[model samples]
Target: MIVRGVRGATTVKANQEKEILDATEGLMRTICEENEIDPENVAQVILTVTEDLTATFPAKALRRLAGWTHVPVMCAQEIPVPNGLEKCIRVMITLNTTKAQSEIHHVYLNEAVKLRPDLQLTKDS
Candidate 1:
Protein backbone atom coordinates (compact mmCIF):
# COMPACT_ATOMS: atom_id res chain seq x y z
CA MET A 1 0.00 0.00 0.00
CA ILE A 2 1.24 3.45 -0.84
CA VAL A 3 0.87 6.49 1.36
CA ARG A 4 -1.76 8.90 0.13
CA GLY A 5 -2.96 12.28 1.26
CA VAL A 6 -6.66 12.94 1.72
CA ARG A 7 -7.72 16.58 1.80
CA GLY A 8 -10.77 18.18 3.38
CA ALA A 9 -11.96 21.65 4.30
CA THR A 10 -14.87 23.27 6.10
CA THR A 11 -16.07 26.64 7.32
CA VAL A 12 -17.01 27.49 10.86
CA LYS A 13 -19.85 29.81 11.76
CA ALA A 14 -17.58 31.62 14.15
CA ASN A 15 -14.12 31.64 15.65
CA GLN A 16 -15.22 30.08 18.90
CA GLU A 17 -13.47 26.97 20.20
CA LYS A 18 -16.52 24.78 19.90
CA GLU A 19 -17.21 25.97 16.40
CA ILE A 20 -13.70 25.19 15.25
CA LEU A 21 -13.65 21.82 16.93
CA ASP A 22 -17.05 20.81 15.68
CA ALA A 23 -16.32 21.81 12.12
CA THR A 24 -12.97 20.04 12.13
CA GLU A 25 -14.45 16.89 13.55
CA GLY A 26 -17.26 16.90 11.04
CA LEU A 27 -14.93 17.45 8.11
CA MET A 28 -12.51 14.75 9.24
CA ARG A 29 -15.28 12.25 9.84
CA THR A 30 -16.74 12.88 6.41
CA ILE A 31 -13.37 12.47 4.74
CA CYS A 32 -12.78 9.17 6.55
CA GLU A 33 -16.24 7.83 5.85
CA GLU A 34 -16.17 8.77 2.18
CA ASN A 35 -12.70 7.33 1.72
CA GLU A 36 -13.24 4.33 4.01
CA ILE A 37 -10.11 5.17 5.92
CA ASP A 38 -8.91 3.26 8.96
CA PRO A 39 -7.57 5.39 11.77
CA GLU A 40 -4.72 2.97 12.31
CA ASN A 41 -3.70 3.36 8.71
CA VAL A 42 -3.47 7.10 9.07
CA ALA A 43 0.18 8.10 9.33
CA GLN A 44 -0.48 11.68 10.30
CA VAL A 45 -2.88 14.56 9.98
CA ILE A 46 -2.01 18.20 9.36
CA LEU A 47 -4.62 20.80 10.07
CA THR A 48 -4.61 24.44 9.07
CA VAL A 49 -6.93 27.27 9.94
CA THR A 50 -7.49 30.64 8.38
CA GLU A 51 -6.16 33.70 10.17
CA ASP A 52 -9.68 34.63 11.18
CA LEU A 53 -9.93 31.47 13.23
CA THR A 54 -7.78 31.57 16.35
CA ALA A 55 -10.02 30.29 19.08
CA THR A 56 -8.36 26.88 19.05
CA PHE A 57 -6.30 24.36 17.15
CA PRO A 58 -8.12 22.01 14.84
CA ALA A 59 -6.08 19.02 16.05
CA LYS A 60 -7.66 19.43 19.45
CA ALA A 61 -10.92 18.27 17.93
CA LEU A 62 -9.39 15.01 16.71
CA ARG A 63 -8.46 14.12 20.28
CA ARG A 64 -12.13 13.82 21.07
CA LEU A 65 -12.50 11.01 18.53
CA ALA A 66 -11.84 7.38 19.36
CA GLY A 67 -8.49 5.82 18.28
CA TRP A 68 -7.08 9.22 17.41
CA THR A 69 -5.10 9.84 20.58
CA HIS A 70 -2.15 7.92 19.16
CA VAL A 71 -2.27 9.61 15.81
CA PRO A 72 0.30 12.24 14.99
CA VAL A 73 -1.66 15.43 14.56
CA MET A 74 -0.34 18.91 13.96
CA CYS A 75 -1.97 22.30 13.60
CA ALA A 76 -0.82 25.44 11.84
CA GLN A 77 -2.09 28.81 10.70
CA GLU A 78 -3.08 29.20 7.08
CA ILE A 79 -1.58 32.07 5.16
CA PRO A 80 -3.90 35.01 4.85
CA VAL A 81 -4.32 35.87 1.20
CA PRO A 82 -6.30 38.60 -0.41
CA ASN A 83 -9.96 37.56 -0.74
CA GLY A 84 -9.20 34.18 0.82
CA LEU A 85 -12.05 32.39 2.51
CA GLU A 86 -12.47 33.20 6.18
CA LYS A 87 -13.20 30.95 9.16
CA CYS A 88 -11.90 28.02 7.19
CA ILE A 89 -10.21 24.89 8.43
CA ARG A 90 -8.34 22.46 6.22
CA VAL A 91 -6.91 19.03 6.84
CA MET A 92 -4.46 16.81 5.01
CA ILE A 93 -4.39 13.24 6.21
CA THR A 94 -1.54 10.94 5.24
CA LEU A 95 -2.55 7.31 5.25
CA ASN A 96 -1.50 3.96 3.86
CA THR A 97 -3.95 2.84 1.21
CA THR A 98 -4.11 0.79 -1.95
CA LYS A 99 -6.49 3.19 -3.64
CA ALA A 100 -5.22 5.49 -6.35
CA GLN A 101 -5.27 9.25 -5.94
CA SER A 102 -8.22 9.56 -8.28
CA GLU A 103 -10.20 7.20 -6.09
CA ILE A 104 -9.74 9.26 -2.96
CA HIS A 105 -12.56 11.52 -1.89
CA HIS A 106 -11.81 15.09 -0.83
CA VAL A 107 -14.48 16.69 1.32
CA TYR A 108 -15.49 20.33 1.30
CA LEU A 109 -18.36 21.30 3.53
CA ASN A 110 -20.45 24.42 4.28
CA GLU A 111 -19.27 27.61 2.69
CA ALA A 112 -15.97 25.95 2.09
CA VAL A 113 -17.67 24.26 -0.81
CA LYS A 114 -16.77 27.39 -2.70
CA LEU A 115 -13.14 26.54 -2.18
CA ARG A 116 -13.45 23.45 -4.34
CA PRO A 117 -16.89 23.18 -5.86
CA ASP A 118 -15.78 20.20 -7.94
CA LEU A 119 -15.08 18.17 -4.82
CA GLN A 120 -18.12 19.30 -2.85
CA LEU A 121 -20.29 16.34 -1.95
CA THR A 122 -23.45 18.36 -1.30
CA LYS A 123 -25.03 21.23 -3.13
CA ASP A 124 -24.25 24.62 -1.64
CA SER A 125 -26.10 27.86 -2.27
Candidate 2:
Protein backbone atom coordinates (compact mmCIF):
# COMPACT_ATOMS: atom_id res chain seq x y z
CA MET A 1 0.00 0.00 0.00
CA ILE A 2 1.21 3.47 -0.87
CA VAL A 3 0.86 6.36 1.54
CA ARG A 4 -1.35 9.30 0.58
CA GLY A 5 -2.64 12.34 2.35
CA VAL A 6 -6.24 13.42 2.72
CA ARG A 7 -6.79 17.16 3.03
CA GLY A 8 -9.85 18.68 4.67
CA ALA A 9 -10.89 21.92 6.36
CA THR A 10 -13.86 23.29 8.26
CA THR A 11 -14.74 26.64 9.86
CA VAL A 12 -16.65 27.35 13.02
CA LYS A 13 -18.89 30.32 13.86
CA ALA A 14 -16.68 31.21 16.81
CA ASN A 15 -13.62 30.19 18.73
CA GLN A 16 -15.49 28.09 21.24
CA GLU A 17 -13.94 24.72 22.00
CA LYS A 18 -17.06 22.66 21.47
CA GLU A 19 -17.97 24.14 18.11
CA ILE A 20 -14.42 23.95 16.87
CA LEU A 21 -13.99 20.34 17.93
CA ASP A 22 -17.34 19.25 16.55
CA ALA A 23 -16.73 20.79 13.15
CA THR A 24 -13.25 19.29 13.00
CA GLU A 25 -14.45 15.83 13.99
CA GLY A 26 -17.17 15.93 11.37
CA LEU A 27 -14.74 16.90 8.63
CA MET A 28 -12.30 14.14 9.64
CA ARG A 29 -15.02 11.48 9.65
CA THR A 30 -16.20 12.53 6.21
CA ILE A 31 -12.69 12.41 4.78
CA CYS A 32 -11.96 9.02 6.34
CA GLU A 33 -15.18 7.50 5.04
CA GLU A 34 -14.67 8.93 1.58
CA ASN A 35 -11.16 7.57 1.35
CA GLU A 36 -11.92 4.15 2.95
CA ILE A 37 -9.27 4.86 5.60
CA ASP A 38 -8.04 2.39 8.19
CA PRO A 39 -6.84 4.10 11.36
CA GLU A 40 -4.24 1.43 11.87
CA ASN A 41 -2.72 2.24 8.52
CA VAL A 42 -2.64 5.93 9.12
CA ALA A 43 0.90 7.20 9.44
CA GLN A 44 0.18 10.55 11.02
CA VAL A 45 -2.26 13.44 11.13
CA ILE A 46 -1.42 17.14 11.26
CA LEU A 47 -3.96 19.77 12.16
CA THR A 48 -3.87 23.54 11.92
CA VAL A 49 -6.20 26.27 13.04
CA THR A 50 -6.26 29.99 12.42
CA GLU A 51 -4.73 32.11 15.13
CA ASP A 52 -8.16 33.33 16.11
CA LEU A 53 -9.00 29.92 17.47
CA THR A 54 -7.67 29.86 21.01
CA ALA A 55 -10.25 27.75 22.77
CA THR A 56 -8.73 24.39 21.92
CA PHE A 57 -6.74 22.37 19.46
CA PRO A 58 -8.68 20.17 17.01
CA ALA A 59 -6.03 17.45 17.19
CA LYS A 60 -6.68 16.88 20.86
CA ALA A 61 -10.38 16.54 20.20
CA LEU A 62 -9.78 13.96 17.49
CA ARG A 63 -7.95 11.70 19.91
CA ARG A 64 -10.69 12.04 22.47
CA LEU A 65 -13.76 11.79 20.28
CA ALA A 66 -12.55 9.55 17.47
CA GLY A 67 -10.36 7.13 19.44
CA TRP A 68 -7.30 7.76 17.26
CA THR A 69 -5.01 6.99 20.19
CA HIS A 70 -2.70 4.75 18.23
CA VAL A 71 -2.31 7.32 15.46
CA PRO A 72 0.22 10.11 15.81
CA VAL A 73 -1.41 13.53 15.65
CA MET A 74 0.07 17.01 15.83
CA CYS A 75 -1.32 20.54 15.81
CA ALA A 76 -0.11 23.89 14.60
CA GLN A 77 -1.26 27.47 14.07
CA GLU A 78 -2.31 28.64 10.64
CA ILE A 79 -1.12 31.94 9.27
CA PRO A 80 -3.36 34.67 10.59
CA VAL A 81 -4.02 36.72 7.56
CA PRO A 82 -6.42 39.60 7.69
CA ASN A 83 -9.95 38.65 6.63
CA GLY A 84 -8.99 34.96 6.57
CA LEU A 85 -11.30 32.07 7.33
CA GLU A 86 -12.01 32.44 11.03
CA LYS A 87 -11.98 29.54 13.45
CA CYS A 88 -10.95 27.25 10.66
CA ILE A 89 -9.46 23.83 11.39
CA ARG A 90 -7.46 22.18 8.67
CA VAL A 91 -6.24 18.59 8.59
CA MET A 92 -3.75 16.55 6.57
CA ILE A 93 -3.82 12.85 7.28
CA THR A 94 -1.10 10.66 5.78
CA LEU A 95 -2.39 7.12 5.44
CA ASN A 96 -1.40 3.94 3.67
CA THR A 97 -3.83 3.00 0.92
CA THR A 98 -4.01 1.36 -2.48
CA LYS A 99 -6.04 4.18 -4.03
CA ALA A 100 -4.54 6.49 -6.60
CA GLN A 101 -4.52 10.29 -6.39
CA SER A 102 -7.33 10.49 -8.93
CA GLU A 103 -9.53 8.40 -6.63
CA ILE A 104 -8.72 10.33 -3.47
CA HIS A 105 -11.29 12.80 -2.14
CA HIS A 106 -10.66 16.07 -0.29
CA VAL A 107 -13.23 17.93 1.74
CA TYR A 108 -14.08 21.51 2.73
CA LEU A 109 -17.06 21.88 4.98
CA ASN A 110 -19.20 24.61 6.60
CA GLU A 111 -18.21 28.11 5.57
CA ALA A 112 -14.88 26.69 4.54
CA VAL A 113 -16.81 25.22 1.59
CA LYS A 114 -16.71 28.65 0.02
CA LEU A 115 -12.92 28.47 0.01
CA ARG A 116 -12.95 25.80 -2.71
CA PRO A 117 -16.14 25.69 -4.73
CA ASP A 118 -14.48 23.67 -7.47
CA LEU A 119 -13.74 20.85 -5.05
CA GLN A 120 -17.16 20.61 -3.48
CA LEU A 121 -18.48 17.05 -3.72
CA THR A 122 -21.57 17.96 -5.75
CA LYS A 123 -22.59 20.42 -8.45
CA ASP A 124 -26.06 20.89 -7.02
CA SER A 125 -24.73 22.92 -4.07
Candidate 3:
Protein backbone atom coordinates (compact mmCIF):
# COMPACT_ATOMS: atom_id res chain seq x y z
CA MET A 1 0.00 0.00 0.00
CA ILE A 2 1.14 3.52 -0.72
CA VAL A 3 1.46 6.12 1.96
CA ARG A 4 -1.19 8.80 2.01
CA GLY A 5 -1.51 12.05 3.87
CA VAL A 6 -4.66 13.18 5.64
CA ARG A 7 -4.91 16.80 6.64
CA GLY A 8 -7.11 18.36 9.29
CA ALA A 9 -7.38 21.68 11.09
CA THR A 10 -9.36 23.22 13.94
CA THR A 11 -9.47 26.41 15.94
CA VAL A 12 -9.55 26.87 19.70
CA LYS A 13 -11.27 29.76 21.41
CA ALA A 14 -8.31 30.36 23.67
CA ASN A 15 -4.66 29.44 24.18
CA GLN A 16 -5.33 27.35 27.24
CA GLU A 17 -3.78 23.88 27.48
CA LYS A 18 -7.14 22.16 27.84
CA GLU A 19 -8.57 23.95 24.85
CA ILE A 20 -5.60 23.04 22.68
CA LEU A 21 -5.58 19.42 23.74
CA ASP A 22 -9.32 19.01 23.31
CA ALA A 23 -9.34 20.57 19.91
CA THR A 24 -6.37 18.50 18.74
CA GLU A 25 -7.92 15.29 19.96
CA GLY A 26 -11.22 16.09 18.29
CA LEU A 27 -9.51 16.90 15.04
CA MET A 28 -7.41 13.73 15.12
CA ARG A 29 -10.44 11.55 15.84
CA THR A 30 -12.43 13.08 13.01
CA ILE A 31 -9.62 12.58 10.54
CA CYS A 32 -9.18 8.95 11.49
CA GLU A 33 -12.91 8.26 11.35
CA GLU A 34 -13.46 10.06 8.08
CA ASN A 35 -10.53 8.37 6.40
CA GLU A 36 -10.90 4.99 8.09
CA ILE A 37 -7.29 5.13 9.24
CA ASP A 38 -5.70 2.49 11.42
CA PRO A 39 -3.44 3.79 14.16
CA GLU A 40 -0.91 1.07 13.48
CA ASN A 41 -0.66 2.15 9.87
CA VAL A 42 0.10 5.69 10.83
CA ALA A 43 3.75 6.41 9.99
CA GLN A 44 3.90 9.85 11.48
CA VAL A 45 1.87 12.82 12.59
CA ILE A 46 2.98 16.43 12.29
CA LEU A 47 1.07 19.05 14.21
CA THR A 48 1.35 22.80 13.86
CA VAL A 49 -0.17 25.66 15.76
CA THR A 50 -0.53 29.19 14.66
CA GLU A 51 1.68 31.85 16.23
CA ASP A 52 -1.03 33.00 18.58
CA LEU A 53 -1.44 29.56 20.13
CA THR A 54 1.45 29.06 22.56
CA ALA A 55 -0.17 27.39 25.51
CA THR A 56 1.08 23.91 24.61
CA PHE A 57 2.36 21.61 21.90
CA PRO A 58 -0.48 20.14 19.91
CA ALA A 59 1.39 16.82 19.51
CA LYS A 60 0.96 16.16 23.22
CA ALA A 61 -2.71 15.44 22.63
CA LEU A 62 -1.97 12.63 20.17
CA ARG A 63 -0.24 10.68 22.92
CA ARG A 64 -3.64 10.04 24.43
CA LEU A 65 -4.56 7.83 21.47
CA ALA A 66 -4.09 4.08 21.58
CA GLY A 67 -1.17 2.55 19.67
CA TRP A 68 0.35 5.95 19.05
CA THR A 69 3.33 5.47 21.29
CA HIS A 70 5.48 4.15 18.44
CA VAL A 71 4.29 6.66 15.93
CA PRO A 72 6.67 9.53 15.24
CA VAL A 73 4.88 12.72 16.20
CA MET A 74 6.28 16.21 15.93
CA CYS A 75 5.00 19.67 16.75
CA ALA A 76 6.02 23.02 15.36
CA GLN A 77 4.91 26.62 15.22
CA GLU A 78 3.20 27.80 12.10
CA ILE A 79 4.69 30.61 10.12
CA PRO A 80 3.12 33.96 10.88
CA VAL A 81 1.50 34.86 7.65
CA PRO A 82 -0.66 37.92 7.18
CA ASN A 83 -4.41 37.19 7.37
CA GLY A 84 -3.72 33.75 8.81
CA LEU A 85 -6.31 32.29 11.12
CA GLU A 86 -5.54 32.69 14.80
CA LYS A 87 -5.60 30.06 17.55
CA CYS A 88 -5.56 27.30 14.97
CA ILE A 89 -4.14 23.79 15.15
CA ARG A 90 -3.40 21.66 12.12
CA VAL A 91 -2.48 18.01 11.75
CA MET A 92 -1.06 16.05 8.83
CA ILE A 93 -1.04 12.30 9.25
CA THR A 94 1.05 10.01 7.10
CA LEU A 95 -0.27 6.49 6.88
CA ASN A 96 0.14 3.39 4.77
CA THR A 97 -3.10 2.73 2.92
CA THR A 98 -4.44 1.50 -0.40
CA LYS A 99 -6.98 4.31 -0.66
CA ALA A 100 -6.59 6.70 -3.55
CA GLN A 101 -5.59 10.24 -2.84
CA SER A 102 -8.90 11.58 -4.09
CA GLU A 103 -10.80 9.36 -1.69
CA ILE A 104 -9.01 10.66 1.40
CA HIS A 105 -11.05 13.01 3.57
CA HIS A 106 -9.64 16.27 4.87
CA VAL A 107 -11.28 17.65 7.99
CA TYR A 108 -11.68 21.27 8.95
CA LEU A 109 -13.55 22.26 12.05
CA ASN A 110 -14.82 25.48 13.63
CA GLU A 111 -13.48 28.66 12.09
CA ALA A 112 -10.91 26.58 10.26
CA VAL A 113 -13.61 25.72 7.73
CA LYS A 114 -12.84 29.05 6.18
CA LEU A 115 -9.34 27.83 5.37
CA ARG A 116 -10.64 25.22 2.96
CA PRO A 117 -14.31 25.55 2.15
CA ASP A 118 -14.08 22.95 -0.60
CA LEU A 119 -13.08 20.27 1.88
CA GLN A 120 -15.55 21.33 4.53
CA LEU A 121 -17.58 18.56 6.10
CA THR A 122 -21.26 18.87 5.36
CA LYS A 123 -24.10 17.82 7.61
CA ASP A 124 -24.41 14.58 5.67
CA SER A 125 -20.69 13.86 5.71
lDDT against the true structure, each candidate: 0.88, 0.82, 0.88
Q: TM per model?
A: 0.94, 0.90, 0.94
For residues 1-125, what per-residue lDDT tens digits would candidate 2 score against the true structure?
89898888888888898988888788888888888787888999999998989898788777764558889899999988888887788899998899998888888887777777887462111
Per-residue error for 31 in candidate 1, Å, reads 0.7
* Total backbone clashes of candidate 1, pairs 3 or more residues apart or in separate chains: 0
Candidate 3 at 38: error in angstroms? 0.9
lDDT of 1: 0.88
Expressed as tens digits, the lDDT of each residue in 14-117 for candidate 1 is: 88999889888888888889999989999999999999998888899999998899999999989989999989998999999999988988888888888887
RMSD of each: 1.6, 2.2, 2.0
Model 3: per-residue Cα lDDT over 1-125, one tens digit each: 99999998899899899999998988888888889888999999999999999888888888898877788999999999999899999899999999998899999888888888876462121
At residue 14, what lDDT does model 1 achieve? 85
